[model samples]
Target chain A: MTLNPNRAAGATPLVAMKDISISFGGIRAVDHVSIDLHAGEVVGLLGHNGAGKSTLIKCLSGAYRMDSGEILIDGEKAEIHNPRDARRYNIETIYQTLALADNLDAASNLFLGRELVTPLGFVDDSRMEAETRRIMGRLNPNFRKFKVPVAALSGGQRQSVAIARAVYFNARILIMDEPTAALGPQETRMVGELIQELKRQGLGIFLISHDIHDVMDLCDRISVMKNGVLVGSEQVGDVTEDEILGMIILGKKPERAGVN
Target chain B: MSDTAEAHGAARKRSFIETLEIDTRLLGMIGAFIVLCLVFHFQTDGRFLTPRNIFTLAIQTVSVAIMATGMVFVIVTRHIDLSVGSLLALCSAVMGMMQVVVMPQMMGMGFGHPLIAPLAILSGVVVGVLIGAFNGWLIGYLTIPSFIVTLGGLLIWRNVAWYLTSGQTIGPLDPTFQLFGGINGTIGPFWSWVVGGLGTAAALWSLWSARRAKQVHGFRVKPAWAELVMGGLVAAAILGFVAIVNAYEVPAARLRRLFEARGETMPEGYTTGYGLPVSVLVLIAVAIAMTVIAKRTRFGRYIFATGGNPDAAELSGINTRLLTVKIFALLGGLCALSAVVASARLTNHANDIGTLDELRVIAAAVIGGTALSGGMGTIYGAILGAIIMQSLQSGMAMVGVDAPFQNIVVGSVLVLAVLIDIIYRKRTGGFK
Candidate 1:
């Protein structure tokens, strides 16, 4: 998905990319893609299943390094060679499976690798519990607390925990891969509310999803891509579903008509 | 009642009531302990519980129990340290050589304060750790399976241990070292009772703390009320065990009479009682420490994560390789510690220092509820399992049970533990 610079806002772009490219083996999965995520903005990357959306996001998340082009974080050129480096850049990613320890509960999942430890040098359960309660209160107040293991949590609650984990670590850019892919209507709405909360916190969210309606409802700007190329980015209010579809299929912006 | 309704009601009650039942592993160990006691008590016509007889049991069981504690950690990580027995033998041989060759040389050099015994022990630990680290590095970083690494380690270490002493017995250790393993009686057996009580209390406290933390953090905590009641019962059981062991004594007041009959002087606390073996105290301490680490530490959590899903752990930013190495090194150090204790008790070090010890140690860990596949276990359970096995060996010997029969019985117990574990996994939807 390409970023459009015409729509200026008060929030600064946390991540600015210029002509990033990544190829696996001999296949160019992502090519010459430019994306900018402003603070407190939800940018939905719209594409077909193989439209290079995931490949591009993976490069940003540091799962794969770009073959060419530069990435700037807050206008500073950043080198992200690994996931750990991406985390240091405040780029937290939530994959489709949630990538959580099923045997561990919400608190443990929230602080999986980086746990709150006590003075005695053990995993500090009390403090972790208090912190989990506070964060869940803000992001998902209705989430049940008794189920400690992630295995027992519902789809929405598990996503909430994964999101909460990234947020708790002070994530500035959240890359969500189909956060509501397997959820029911009510659960999807719950996630929608969560995305809104993150947006209010000035977090730049790059949501990659197949649901166009979800993109229209939540994203500030929608970028369509097809065949490893950026089609165009348009303000959600200005673009119709047909126009977005056309951009995805043809890799070019459709002509604007006189209709409202 | 209608047949279908009756069956449904019965199933509901069974499901509800089953939660209160003792876990199968615990049940198995306790059952084994009781049956052994009964067999020995009946066969010996109640003479097996005599103070002298009980002390014999203490010494007999210490070596296996110590090894089992270390085995618990390795097994929990879904790895096997087949080198423990080899490490044990090697360490003891080093200690023996220090006592026989090095100390005498030091004494000849006019060094009044001979440091060979202590130095030998330290060397043993270092050697064990280094070998363990080597094995750990191979298995952890190189992504080798634990069984293969430890199997290779077993051969290498056992040969080293054998070569260290020229495959011969080396003995006549310092009196101080001997006292640790020997001197089964002291201060009227009160010290043993105190140690037991303190040990049991510490176990209870740590168990409570772990469960409390799990509850607070919203971890999958066991039922609190059940845990508390179980803790109290275990504490009380220790107290009761102390009372029973004390009762088994010939009476301290009577010990003086035997001495008087022979017109000989006696040491303090010489009066007869089961009194604690230093080995037993060491065993209990190891158990408590292991439980704390496995349940409450970040390292322990990593161990579980590594076992449950290595890929997921790696993705979570855990150094799975490093964790595996640390666990193996811990196994080696623990085995060395056990070797030191065992040598102190035997008052000798030899080629057969830890003969067939692997079977007993691994058996204890397995029987204690540690999964051979890893990801679930308790140190306390491992200790209980070791104690049960040791008791069986001692009790059977006391009852004049044939050696072949004892071996068969122990083998059956091991097989039964594995079977019980299988059933548990099935019942619990394959606890991983």
Candidate 2:
């Protein structure tokens, strides 16, 4: 993939994944997919199951290594072979399953791989709990169960933990896979507001969702994929909800929204 | 929830148990252990609780107890090590050869050399680490199941030990090495109280500092009274154990023999206590070190995290495969250490050394409150579990129970322990 003309004209997108191709055995899970996001923008990746959206996003998140692809952050090629590498580039993920170690407390889950260590190299647990308490107090003031395992937490509380983990580490580019899929309507609205807040703080987000309505309401642009290929990318203002749905289902771009 | 407001309310409202923050499951395990001890004491007509009997039990428990600590880590990571006993035998055989045969006879170094003990220990531990790494590689990189890998290891290593020693006992090890076995070696009464005193001080210091640290961070701390009570109880336990072990007097005949060896005439009416066995000290060091690694280190956190949800751990940037290798390797090192104590205690390494120790070690860990399902276990619990297992066997033997019947009873106790643990955890809403 060539460099975007927009990069030469002005600012680089916060993240640019170009020509990502990955395969399992002989089957191609993601085929030559390219996607990008810019600062302060919410890019919704919409597709049905087996449309390779998750696979494509996993490559960017460093959960899966793309067979042939380059990921650029702020116009520089970033080599992320594992989640640790992705983290170093300020890329964080909230997986569809929330991906918290259920046996560990919320503070342990939050710090996780990068724990707050003491001067003598032991895990600084109390400090971590205090930090978790401080952050949760800001993010979800009602959060009081800091000592219990995340398995005992409610759906919204768990979601907030996943989000807080990303936010605490100062994520510049966030990959959220079905962040509200398991939450109630009220919790869903709360997540919608959280996404807005992240966007307001100029953090680029890639929201992978099956809901066309969520894309229409919260996304700045929509990238639809089908059968391991991208149909097209369109601005939310240009494409109606029906057009986006057609693109997801039929894997074809509606002509009206193709111009701009 | 400002500083004084929260602390004052919690201090006034919380019960003693709540303030201590002790695990209910751990308390239950300890309660069971104590009950078992009491039953054994009664059944054996009080012989089981005698100072001499308890001291002997401590030495007998050391080898398996040390191995059980490692088993806790293995089980916590959702793995089982059926090879530990065989590994111990192999380690013992290797060390025996190093000190008695290989270095002294073949390498032309005299036996009982100071270097012989250290060199033997190093060789044994290295061999264990290599084998453990091999097992871990099969499990982690090759994706072989741990149970199958270790089961195969159980057979392969036992025969390998036989091959190493030609199915003969390797013995008359270096004298320095024998000290590790608690065979005619002990710290005596004076140093025992010193260790107990230092341990008491450290325990109290940790409790105080932890409370202060919490307060400094504006986090909730236990009440002043609760902290004092906790400290007092810990200190008392430490000193009490030291006192019991120290009460076992050294025999007059053995004291006379010791004086003759040192080229001195025995004094009339002289008596002394065998304060602490070296083997027991080794086990204690292992317990403390293992506890620290489990509670305060990154490796330990990754272990629980991976055991909890492997996908989550991997996504969190932990190299779980490597972690597996490291864990098995650590257990292997512990196995070698246990071998040192076992063979040394025997005054020689026999072909049948550590035979069936696998079942005993696993039982100890399980009884000690280690969850077979993973993401849970405690070093202290496993040590106490080892004590309970040993006490059962010793108490039965004291009562003149048949050896076969003793096995039947111990086997039944293992199953009952697991069952009770499951029901307790389920009722308490603990992590299953």
Candidate 3:
């Protein structure tokens, strides 16, 4: 199925990844996929494992380079060669594996690359810890073991630290890959509220998930991919949960969802 | 440290040491050190702790200890530089050639020209840094494993050193350079006390300012008395070391020779002590500078972070490849610095200078609690590790133990220290 590759008439998308394709070892992990996100919107990217959902999002997150594609940020071409470049565009990612330095403390992990520094150019560890505490206080008030390395924390605690790192950074565009895979149900709800909060703050988020209910609950639009191809992109109200699942499972296009 | 201890503190009522916020691991190491000293003192008929012997040990540890400080970071990053001993020899040879052969022949600058020693030192350091950068480039850019690259360096640099000197010893170095060797240059008792006072002041001020910073940040601060007591303990340690070193008096015969050389008469009962050797002072400065780098600087942070998780560090925007080059380059500079102290101490550069020193440095860093797997080390720990290694060897020698037997004991001690460190980390729930 040919997905529509058009921009809104007047409003520019906060991020538009156009015609992205990449391969590894003669296998097309992501092939000619295009997606866009607007401010104050949550775009759910749904697929099974090895369905190219992750590979496609990784291009915009700067974890992978597309074979041929260009990323436009707010209608301007953006050059994202690395995670550092992606960060410069105020883009932050919370990977499925969390991508945290396990041996460092919560504050150190949060400020790993861009540390808060004193006037004398030393890492202002105290200020960072305080800020971490302030943010965690709002995210998870029970997070008292701030001083230990994340390696020592429980699964849920570690999840919050990863979440707090992304949330505290004030990212204009956020990418989350299976963020709730390690989180408890309560924590999952907390993240749902966080997504809502970030949405009202006018940030664009790309939430990659397999849970249809979660997508329907949190996302405004859903993009489903199968075998390195985008099968459909549909509004939450315009589609039912089963139709979205069919697109995810059988690579059904949006037009066929209406016919069936 | 405050890192994990605060969480432990919150869990239950704290112990005395925990309340004081002292690292239990460091305290345990210190305890072991003192115990080792006491046993040696008994075996050596009290000779081990005598002022003269203690002073000698301090000077002897300087060369290896300086290199060990750099080795901590190297090991912390899970890389090994097996060429340090060879690098030290090469640096010493370069400095020697600069002083005895190159300076007079090329620059036409004869001995006692002042530029000879300074220029020679600079040349040695440049060679070290350049070679270090080359090694780093191979490991970081060429994607060669550090172990293989440095292992090759161990053999290559040693041969290079031999070729530079043509298997000969260069001697009768610039007289001023010998001062760093300890006997020729000693800051007298007065200056030692002054330095001690300044060190105490710095320690106190640092402690106070840290407390102030904590208060400003609204984090949990330690009790005021705990800070005061810790400060007092550090001050006492610095002052005590100075006092012990100051107790070693210049022999009357040597004093008389000095007076005669100056054409000055020696007065009766006019005695003075060699308070601290300049080499030891240099090690202290290196320790301070390395600690500051490890704790305060972004470069140091990236190193540990990379060691902890290279993927995470890379994703966090750290240029880890460039950092590797810088780390090795820093280590090479330190090796050159060690060469300076070593060659100065020998009063010449020798064929076997710095032989087997790479093992000693790696042993020191590992003993100091730098995990070989990567991502955990401390500068002070490495220095203490060097000290412990030196003390064990020297004490065994004083008790008439054979050289091979001394090596066996030191080797066993290194293994035992790492075993203990691993168990402690496992028990304490530290990073796996």
Candidate 4:
């Protein structure tokens, strides 16, 4: 596998979290860690369980507050006190749970927080459905169950709703936690195609996953974390699967790799 | 290729079955209501379908139906209010006292004044809202489970009613106040027909606009014939109701016969028509308003969303706790309105008024298709559920069914409705 040669050549980092730290109870869940994502790039976050990768991403998604850290978006300091704050910065997170209201139809769930309303303060459901259809045409052309509750949908289609929600809201930075974790091979490939399409549209994505093959196939760069600490980050072409595995289990960088 | 063709045919049949199953529960409820009416119509020797009996049944349904509409909201938000009956009683007691005792004394009027009835009803509603707000505050802000809070309220509020009236019935309410709940307080036949015509127009307009909007958005819509069929059904239902009431005229001959039976001479030119009862009109207005709130408003969407998934709703920037409070408060206001209707109908207020009514209200909502576990319900369904419940009671009584047997039947129906709902959910892939 080879990385795109121009992956990180001249793009400015769109989001940077410096020395982020957080603790649960008396234990440090995430030790001092720093990571940056450039515009139009897909950065894969790989880690074993309890490695604090999710917790670290949670801080950026505004699901958790870091004990000590500063986050910069587009080189400006950003204070994200909650999920709404993260949304204001055009950052949307698709949690592993998908965070969808199961009883609502696709258009309703897509506009759950920010509904389209007529001048009379009535929910403009027709307009919302039309918009959902337009966006789904681009993201998942096969989607057709617009009126059924999302709970009746397949996992892949539900993921499409979640993705469409984030993307339709003009999100520039996306944090997708295990986007392909519960999908079949076909669905995983579908998500992979979606990620590639999103990348082409110049959105920076932080994809947290344990699937190394997925990381290699879709990510421009891979960052591995172990025990709440950064083991290493390398351009995908700069290392092989064995070296990435060694870094994950042994908590050491490959000797031949150039530091990213 | 033959196998593929067979599979396609089977798939189409299966999809058709699925759509039928999806709609059958509501259709079943409607069918059950019609069957019940038919059986009772035969059992009563045609008296059950008489306009007078039907009008009386509608009036009896108003109080329960009004509360059932509110119960849909309460239950949709994943909460239960067992205190509604007691709340109604207490509000009735307060309103009765204000009209019969407090207002007269304060104004120094020897007889009840015209303004006293309206003032008393307003106070009753205010008291209802206050109690509802308190319940909401505890359940929403204090994070107490609604079941425990409202259960505690059931005991406390009923006792408060008993204490307020000192176990005595307050009686002989103001004549004008009694009109709000009386049979003669109905809109006349002419006005009833006018109202029915207007309602038919509104229904057709709404259907046309919805179809037009869907088409404008380039979405799939029902055929024009389907819309026309629906509009025709609504018009028939409304106009039929008006026709029934208009047919209930008290002929001068029947009046003379009654006067002779009572050993009195008949008066000249005595006549009457039942028209539409004022209480039924109140119920209809409440149903329409609640339907709008449940279908169109942001608050209504929030209620469903909160009931569907509290965590997701919270993360989506919904102030779920505040929404919970608002829903409970709305329930309270409805309880007050119900109290007014109940007290007016009786021309009196008693300690036992509205006792066991909470059960009936809850039963009506559940029967109508509001999920007890929440997140799915409709106002029209609740009203129909109320109708079914009252029909069962009235029909059984007319057929000389014992009181205990009536309870047994109603309880079994409630359980059956919920069981059907569960089966429906399972068929639909289990509660989303």
Candidate 5:
């Protein structure tokens, strides 16, 4: 395992994962991987399919139990053993499919797991609806509320609802998996803007994307991986698409090694 | 503006295929209703629409409709309760046996007096709730598929009912017990009109309030006029039904007339308005209550969420197992209640009571737009579905269709309903 770079100037890392290793059937999927994310920073996790990027994130999200690792949130050591534990640490994940129930509209989805109840012992739908409108007004102004089922909503609107569900629950760390996958250019941009807004709210985002362009445009830091190993983490402004591609192809970061 | 208007007009003129593609269940239900009307219209020389037959129709639909109300909840959570029929039979048999055994014992103990009927109802409810809880625990906490659990329960509970009754009919219930199955005294249909009118008004008010809240919040709201139109149609249907029912004698009155052949005349002009059958009122209340709970409560919302996508619901932190158990328990309790009403009406709780009703209850829910795959259905729709089934049975019988033929007709109707549901789903892109 290689050492992480020093924090630049006054910017402290919001999260530092050190010596993370996980295996399946004695085969290392994430072998001694280490990464850091800063407050209000968008860090892109980039690798080819099956290059262990997802496995590493799943470990961080408590979807997979890590064999060995030390995770620090805001420089404090933390253990996340399950999704509930992750939630307690204010970590939220929005899967690529959005996972919103199509039959329930935005308000219902916004409060899907934790609904506001009235004093009368029923679901305070009115309160939920009002809260949904308020949150959506800040998140995605174009969202519609009158729809009985969300099946009628556009894909971007659906994603907005899913993101709003996580954000409304006070998530400090947002993990988005291919947020713009399968979306049109307009919807993609819409999600990109939403992600930026979340960043402005001071959330540290771990964005997993296959599109190198998306990473270059939206991410502040890019971490490249190959074959269950971390190649290098570079500032997006300092790295090129081809350089990252080389790291993915050669299983070693040439630029970091001063060999490029 | 003109171009936009023209585009909108073009969209409106899209093919029926497109409409079917958008709302498969709607088309399927409408199509089924049309087919049923056509068949009944052709069969009894149009007597199916007569007041007497319609009165009979309400009575025939009550028990199934009531049970279907709860079955909607069970089905919505992607579960089935086969023990519902058995539960009903057990409740009725217990109630019947209690009249002979438990009630006399109470009288002997000097604790009953006039409390026997109330005690009987209480016992029925407690038994139902306990059975429901047991079923829920088995399916939800034990991680058994509901079908297997309820199927085993269905056989076991029916055997219990038979064993309790010694495989004989238990009957001659207290007159107060029979009151549940009898019609309330008639008020020339005025009471039905008043109650139905109030119900419609309440519905309209809630719809208006919901829309108002949406508009005030600048949320994309359903059009006010559209809801008003739909509510108006429903209100009109209720008013029309009241008028039709008010014009006819309740089934209880008819039964009384048959009893009058032995020189006993029913009280002059006895009527229960359109509220003739207490079971009908029970069915309506159950339907409304379940609908409100499913559409308006957090737990109800969870039921749909769990049914539609269990993984997501679980991720959201819902106790999905607990919800399943609660829903199954509700179904069991409701089935027991239905059994009491129905058995009392029959004047006996036979070991064979509630037999084959499970198929009808499930069939009604499935036909009423409940998805076998879960996360889609309504209690109101289930009631409508039950009505369609009951109408077919009653209309065929009115035209002299024998029991064997009636079974064939019903079986075919159930199959047709499923076929229509499938076709509707395919047309509407329910499955991708």
Candidate 6:
């Protein structure tokens, strides 16, 4: 797939993490990793299991505290002590498990923490349902089950709920960890379309997955990490699937023109 | 074209069946309650349906039902309160000692002083809250498992209650204080009708407003006739209860009738209706408040979320530990209220009061469809469950069943209810 790099050469990156490091029980899980994301772009993080890709992204999502790192949003230092702080900075994450309450309906799950309430301080279900419908219409027009609990929904519909929640909250930077891991091919295509729509709206996304084909098909730039270190970052148009695979398994950068 | 039409019709029919099958456990409870009533009515030669009998049954259900409403929240958040029965005993002991022994002696006033009643109740509830806060802190902030903490509480609180009275029964409560628990202290017939009518109106208004909101939002809603039928059913149930209570004549009028039958003159101005019992009204108010909390409040939603998945709830910015503390404290307050009602009804605080009541309260919640595994329940369902349990005990007693057999039957019914709940969830594809 041909790709055009979305980050302008001189424009400030949307987010930058410098020398982020974290350890678990005396083992370095993520060490000295630096990465950046830009608006209107898709950056794919590819690695093997336990390669520290998830741990690294978790720091940005505020699920984990990095041992040493500086995070900058729009070239300005940002402090994220917890998930609430991350949300305040317009950073929403869609974990592989989706983190939804299984027994609550779609609208309830969508507004789980930040519920809409009336003047009487009661949860306004009707208003929340309306908002959910409006957003789902934009993200996935075919989604119709608003009253059923998420446990009753198909995998793709559950994903739609998770995605719609992130997007509806005006998220500027989204981190999706293996969004299409359990989906069928058709659902995977649907997620791809959703990501493309999000990109068109100028939201920067960090797509974390082990699927090389998905990265080639959807990402503007691919960042490969192996054993807690960044192997290399390359524009998709400048690297082949074999070379990316080589970087993932062998932790070796391909000698490609104009690649860093 | 014909095939397509047939397929559409079948799909519509299937959806209708699906809607009917939703919450089958609730439907099962309703069915079981009706069956129990019929059996008791037949077994007692129609005495079970009498206004007098029904009134007593409602009173009997109120104390446990009140606690069950709070239990719904506790169990919904994946916790248990084995200490409620003991808590009730302790609160009642405190109230009795304050009203009957301490307050009168300290103030040099008679026990019948009206001030004594409210003061005793307040102190009782305050003590309950303090104890509950202690329990909440241990389980929530200290990270102790609720099961172990509450199990320990069950033993400790009961011992404290026993120690408070030194195994002596406190009795013959003040007349003014007894009114809260006695039948003669009930509201009159006129006010019962007024309250019932207002309750019906509120129910209808809520239904209509919900429909209007759905329409305004352009969301799919039930058909107009379906809503109308639901409203009518609720109204009938409320009106029927009022009619039953109104049928019971006052004890003074009955005494006057007996005197007249003996060919003697009767006292004038002895006319009155049984009206509604004070405790029953209290239970109704608690039920309404709890239902609203469970269905429409953020705290209620957090309870369910915490039960559904603690990790997700915390990651969503909810403080699950703090929520746990608040829920336990609320349960404690409910326990205090139950103590007030129980003590007032019997006009005494005995060592055996509230014995084994925690088991009954938990059974009622489980029968009402509150899962022990957590994440799903309703306050109304818990109330109905309490009614079902009381009905069984009342029916079996009227039928002259042995006490041990009654225990066996009640235990079996509880196990059967949970088994049915599991099957119903599986049939409906609910999360286990």
**How far off is each candidate at the interface, as Cα RMSD in Å?**
8.4, 4.8, 2.3, 6.5, 6.1, 6.3
lDDT of 5 by residue, B1-432 (tens): 122223356455544344222243554576777788678878778777877677777876778888898888888788888888888998887887777677776457332347767778778877888899889998889999889998999899989989988898877776667766634323346677787788778877876776776577564444445565667767887777777877775567565865587787777655554444566667778887888789778879999988877877776667788887788778877887787678767767888888888988988888788888888887877888888888877777777888899999889888887887778667654632
* TM-score, candidate 5, first chain: 0.90
Candidate number that wins on DockQ, 3 or 5: 3
Determine the TM-score of chain B of model 6. Answer: 0.92
lDDT of 4 by residue, A212-248 (tens): 9999988888889999998888988888999999989
For candidate 2, give the lDDT of residue A197.
93
Give chain B TM-scores in order: 0.82, 0.95, 0.97, 0.90, 0.85, 0.92
- Displacement of residue A257 (Cα, Å) in model 4 is 7.6
The alpha-carbon lDDT assigned to residue B244 of candidate 6 equals 86
DockQ for each numbered candidate: 0.22, 0.52, 0.59, 0.39, 0.31, 0.43
Instruction: List model 1 lDDT by residue over B228-328, tens digit each.
Output: 67787788877765665665666666777768889986688654565555566666677767766876788877777666555556566677778878888
User: Where is model 6 more than 4 Å wrong at Cα?
Assistant: A1-6, A256-260, B1-24, B107-110, B182-184, B253-269
The sequence of per-residue lDDT tens digits that candidate 6 reaches over residues A74-137 is 9999998878888888998998887889988889889989999999999999999889989998
lDDT of model 5 at position B167? 91
* Real interface contacts reproduced by model 6, as a fraction: 0.52
Q: Candidate 3 lDDT, tens digit per residue, B90-158? A: 999999988988897777887777888888889999999999999999999998999999999999997
Model 2 residue A12 lDDT?
81
When summed lDDT is taken over every stretch of 10 residues in candidate 5 chain B, the lowest stretch is B1-10
Candidate 1 global TM-score: 0.82
Q: Rank the candidates by TM-score, best first.
A: 3, 2, 6, 4, 5, 1
Off by over 4 Å in 5: A1-13, A16-36, A59-72, A75-85, A116-148, A224-243, A253-260, B1-42, B45-47, B97-99, B106-112, B182-201, B218-232, B243-245, B250-275, B425-432
TM for candidate 4 is 0.90
lDDT of model 1, residue B421: 79
- For each of the candidates, the C-alpha root-mean-square deviation to the true structure, in angstroms, is 5.9, 3.1, 2.8, 4.4, 5.3, 3.9
Candidate 1 stretches greater than 4 Å from native:
A1-12, A17-34, A45-70, A79-82, A145-148, A222-260, B1-58, B106-114, B182-188, B197-232, B244-264, B267-270, B392-412, B429-432
Q: Write model 4 residue lDDT over B235-283, tens digit each, in one string.
A: 9999999999877886677668868999998767767676887888888
List the per-model TM-score of the A chain. 0.91, 0.95, 0.93, 0.96, 0.90, 0.96
For each candidate in turn, the TM-score is: 0.82, 0.96, 0.96, 0.90, 0.82, 0.92
